[model samples]
Target: MSNNGSYSNDRPPSAGETELATDPASGVLFLSDYKKHEDLQQMLDSNKDSLKLEAMKRIIGMIAKGKNASDLFPPVVKNVVSKNIEVKKLVYVYLVRYAEEQQDLALLSISTFQRALKASEFFIPVLLVDPNQLIRASALRVLSSIRVPMIVPIVMLAIKDSASDMSPYVRKTAAHAIPKLYSLDPEQKDELIVVIEKLLSDKTTLVVGSAVMAFEEVCPERIDLIHKNYRKLCNLLVDVDEWGQVIIISMLTRYARTQFADPNADDDGEDSTNKPFYEDEDDIDGEHDPSKEEKIKKTYSLDPDHRLLLRNTKPLLQSRNASVVMSVAQLYHHLAPRSEVHVVAKALIRLLRSHREVQSVVLNCIASVSTKRKGMFEPFLKSFFVRTSDPTHIKLLKLEILTNLATETSISVILREFQTYISSNDKEFVAAAIQAIGRCASSIKEVTDTCLSGLVSLLSNRDHDVVAESVVVIKKLLQTQPSEHREIIIHMAKLVDFINVPQARASILWLLGEYSDRVPKIAPDVLRKMAKSFINEEDIVKLQILNLAVKLYLTNPKQTNLLCQYVFNLAKYDHNYDIRDRARFLKQFIFSENSKLSKHAKKIFLATKPAPVLESRFKGKKRWVPYHTILTPGRLAIMTCLLSLKFLLILL
Candidate 1:
């Protein structure tokens, strides 16, 4: 390769690779790269150290230029025995570059790296306080990893002194070394805890995280040591690196939960769940300003340090690091007031734009938090809509989040997004969309007509899974409002003969049998169709067939007696034990005048069930506007936010 990135070939040209030269036969203008490679190879085999070092430097330069030089590995490995330390370092640097792709070559060089370490006790202490931070850190790590039992005393002494080293880099290294020493000599764990506590109070954010880690491993029971450092750790949380912030924030969250009273607990005759986080209710939505009496509510109170922690911690939600954002969000959930937990919602939503792995974890947090404090996420509903390119897991979580965010005002827009999802090529996504629609209908009464219409349209879908899952969600909705969706029951019963999915078949039978009073003529017809194929049907469908048969027998004993009897007889001799037992119980209940429980079988199958409240934590409670979040910049505290986000409706 020439310097200007244009190739000059003195030898045969590579395939599709052109050479730039004024003369090709005489080779007047071009430099020969082939001869340059051979010259460098000859220098690597020389007896003098300087020639080998110079040759290795050229190889390092070639590797840095993105050139393949695996042919030089054997020469580099031979140079590790050089008396010059710089030559060994350059050779190792070259070897490390190709370690992953050249695993066999790296294995051949393992003993070479091991031979470079000086692990003797006589020379160990001298390197522990070396002026170079990398050497000081590496020396301790290598010494700790040495397996000789006699070297334990040297490793312990080296760790104790280095734990208080002037360089924070060395102290952080010592923190990692403490755990290894403790593992080798468990007797020194308590003494190591004392050393770790000093490292924790080092007045540097650099060492505090690792010190706490060492403390966690050395003596986790010694949390009493953390009390003095609690305020200091909170102060240094932002200054710490991303990983350090994750560790410290997790430790602080655990500490705050146990020491402080619940942030949601009623304080001085006030229920925080019903109150919003802001001082004025009119600030969040500009549409209707509340009256003065309702606008000014008492602030949800907190302990001083808790207030300081939250005050200092809110800006980290915009961190470039995903784990840092996640850690801060969790801290708010665990320690902040109930009304303020929604502060993490927008931050978590922003993570959807990240890579799929981070998006997955962020979605899980959204799913858990939205189940309890859904109103907190209401403003950002469109952020949860499924993207066309999302993976299956992300799509599933977004579906759950969108379903949980459904409300009377927002259900219309949510149903519109669900309509698009129902048409996707992925069957699982289609089914989840169908389920999301059913959930919206079950939760919001106004949208039940819309969700039912969408689901009924899906019953005509060409994909079998879409129609099957649609039936399952529709069954749940119909069971909840058995009388309101009478028309849906007739439509579902029409597809029963053509449907082959067991869950869908069982769901169809359940809707027909449970609401048999609404579709009386279709009930016996479904039962007659089911009785002919009862032997081939799944156990689930078979059980539902018995329930449908018995429910129909109670409604009209004269017209459906023989049809019900045949289903019962086929079920009685079925392969499954549960099916047989259920069949015998239903047949005895309906056909016998001998049992006392048979008289009121009508009341058993046709009992009226109350509508299910969507399982959520703050469903009935008032929506909360999280702390430090205000639309109008209502106070000086809003200025503390690092970045203010204006969430817009994401247009499809």
Candidate 2:
């Protein structure tokens, strides 16, 4: 017989007839006899074991490739009683593939599978205790694949027996089998949980990891079962594989959250035994209050179990694996005490020495932590300074962190760093640097003069982007510090010719209109020069110019009446509806006989605008929780199928 399950002659081919023949034209094997189900059925009924085995392999390969081999299930099951191990293995492979599709027909194989599970060779159970670990694991896997509930007891006995096998490989395989049994029949979950909990204490890390994974899938809500083994699992956490570490950390995080009550609650609605002491009155004359001291001490304290978990996890911060570090950091941030959060934050910073991708993630986590716990990362402020070799995204993240950590004590150090960044050739970095400086000046009053001075000096930068960004920062600064920084008007006036970008031009025009009375001579020329290019400017610049022209006319109508009229005339016939409407409203307000409405319009736009503060993108949002998985549903299915295939291969 050929590999295609077709006999070349009337009688079966001899042992040497194992070679397959190919078509001369297509270079493909020509299975002329096995094209239909009848040919494959005939081959399965042949007396020769080789022919039956070849037929079974062809059918399985077809089924694996998504062909319909359901009609051959009866013929495939007939060979289950064959004495040849190789032939029986192939038949078992065929059964597992189509069993769920043809459940009624699969019931016929339960008796044969049970007999094979109990088969003995020279008084030794060959299938279960075979010297080859793969053969033993495979036999156990196949027995578990039969989803019929009638065979559940048989499969359970086999799994329980294999769980204690001397081979660690068999023990691991047994651990994975628990979830399969529970999934097949939810009633068996309690019994399987008992079996899984025993394997958790198994000395082998491989078995323990697999066992915890099974527990996570089968009995995740029953976390109390792990309380007895919590210390042992934490001790072995670092020694497991990277993926296993993620699972253990997630489990520990859940356990910690459950074990400890809400930290924010002074009384967790529990009995008096769990409540800590509190002080009801304020201290007088700066004297120490013993009740306040006790409350502070109790808030920072941790129970023995949580303390141990944190201690074991601290070393993982220096781990070479990025996922491990991130998981540990998230665990500390979510469940650990606030006072101990600095330890994890420092660990995240250490991860910056890794790749750029890791650096970006670490910086984001650090930024979140620092924002919540103010001044926690202040001592190590210099660690966030941008390096020249860092990528653009990473540089941006570091700059944000620097801005978040700025305060009275660290403002000077951060300002010096910003000065260096402003001189860099990267236009985006310089722009961000200038913005960061302006934010610091807005928030910290002491640094206002120094930061504004630094920004004023950057207006001379040759790069148009840098100069444009400086104009924007200075505009914001003027909104907050208009009285002290009137000197910036002279410097901004000198840069009118250098500013060509629409946004920059709009900023300078807005400044002149708001402070027109401060620099009256130079303001009109800037507006007239901007008026010449009004037809070609973008909508944003045009809108700012119109508003500035209104301001110029209202403040200094003697010298700027015609310039404002030219802008209003150009805007009145303009295509944009917003511009035309504004032109009409301003014309009515400025030249109207209704003095009451015109004064109201003047008072509204002239009011002091609020200062801009540096806020995190995640401000006022909930803290982020990292996702960890023991085994996803898709992965579980794939693992079950692969184990079934391995069982069939071992028989061959």
Candidate 3:
């Protein structure tokens, strides 16, 4: 070995020469030759720069393929002291990868890493302040990878100096290094907090994002740190990239909630705040009070911070980026004053104009938000109308929002639009549309007649699925408002032949049984027709037929007694235990002639079910939107692993 730059020509071939070769098919060089670990030692001792670079490349390729390159750590460590910047970068990469894996050997390379950290020409300050941002960033990265507590002070100082560097790229790298330092010595959090907060005001958006990320990781609970920067964060909320927007919005929401401990200081409780200002005609007995409406509007304006967050975030709802829209919407939903949350709700509706995949996500967010603030979105009901060009999923989601937003003012428009969907050629959309119409009917008494008329007309639809779904919805509608929709029983009976589905048949049978006294002439005929396929009918149909038979016998015993007797006998011998048991119970109950039990059964069968209503999608639930940040556990782990591997390829 020679101390000078030159070495004897007797040195062995580098590992690159002994182990790597080019594949003919892909034209990519790969490590194919399996040489002993000592071959790497011989290559590292060589004075040839080209040979060393090639050997390091080969080692990095091996490491990338997930091979154990720790055995070569000794020679790789020696190369870290090389004057060649490229070789130093490759060596640093290899050290980061194997540092934690080969901690013992990694300790031997710390001195070399420190030397590179401070390496510079006579007039150059240090590698930390190197002219090339890449070199500067690489130096900070390498220093961060050394996890020894004893070196924490040196790494901390390097990060602090790099944080103030003129390069935004270097400043971002320093922001990332703060967490690594804190993890090595958590007690240093106080020391790093100052540096992290300073980076928050960096001129570059990327640097600001990185700084916020650092603050979240080091002291997320320190609301005081965020208090001073709250307005700045809101103003910069839109400029940061998508991921940064998530962090900043989440932090702002936390700060707002903390500062305004009682969100209902002027507003009501959470549920009351979500209640819509505009009520249906029935809510006020069809009378509109001008003074009350004026009072309600006056109470709904936004507070200072809430107004600021909304002002900054409202524009983000129109962002072409889905993540930005979702984050801003979630922030508004969780933190905005109740009176102004409607603005955010409408903003989310506008996102439906984006791509289909995005439309689906936006619809889901709207659905979740609408449960809390339904009236806020009622005015935007037209926007959710299904577009013929939308994908099936989007169309279905749009239909859901439409139904959710249905009210006295919007029901007529929604019903008319649903009629068009029911006539669509797409069977699935038609079925969903028919169901939507039925749901609207069940919810709003004003639309019950019009919706049922539309549904009854769909019985003549050519699509069997459309007819079947129509019958299902009609069944639900009849259950909800039996008295109001009883006239449709005749139309439903006429469509019994067209209803081929088991569930559809079951629904019709239930309708016939419940309204037997109303449609006595046709009810028995429908039950008898269903009985012809008694052995072949589905279990659900069988159960409904059994119940209908019992009800028909009770309601119209003269016309249905013999028919009910035959069906009950067949069911009593059926293979299914449930049907058999039900048959026996009905027979015993009928023969016993207990008037009280008979009346109880009649009342139970004829009782009106609660109207079909959309349950709160997010009631008693925290409004959560999935957003990725550097502080997340999975992201942090992946970053650590990738940083290690990337350093190997770039430096070693």
TM-score of each: 0.71, 0.64, 0.69
Over 4 Å off in model 3, which ranges? 1-26, 30-136, 139-171, 174-207, 217-219, 235-242, 261-320, 334-353, 370-385, 405-413, 423-426, 553-569, 577-600, 614-652
Cα deviation of 285 in candidate 1 (Å)? 34
List per-prediction Cα lDDT, in the order shown. 0.74, 0.75, 0.73
List clashing residue pairs in candidate 3: 89-651, 89-652, 90-651, 90-652, 91-651, 91-652, 93-647, 93-648
Q: lDDT (0-100) at residue 28 of candidate 3?
A: 40
Per-residue accuracy of model 2 over 218-270 as CA lDDT, tens digit each: 99988767866777787888788777788888888888888765444455543
lDDT at position 34, candidate 3: 34
Q: How accurate is candidate 2 locally (lDDT)?
A: 0.75
Off by over 4 Å in 2: 1-204, 207-232, 262-299, 374-376, 517-525, 553-562, 575-599, 618-652
- Candidate 3: tens digits of C-alpha lDDT, residues 232-321: 677777788888887777777777776653444553543323232223212212344657556644665334445456677788777776
Error of 1 at 447 (Å): 2.0
Candidate 3, overall lDDT? 0.73
**Ranking of all predicted structures according to TM-score, beginning with the best and ending with the worst:** 1, 3, 2
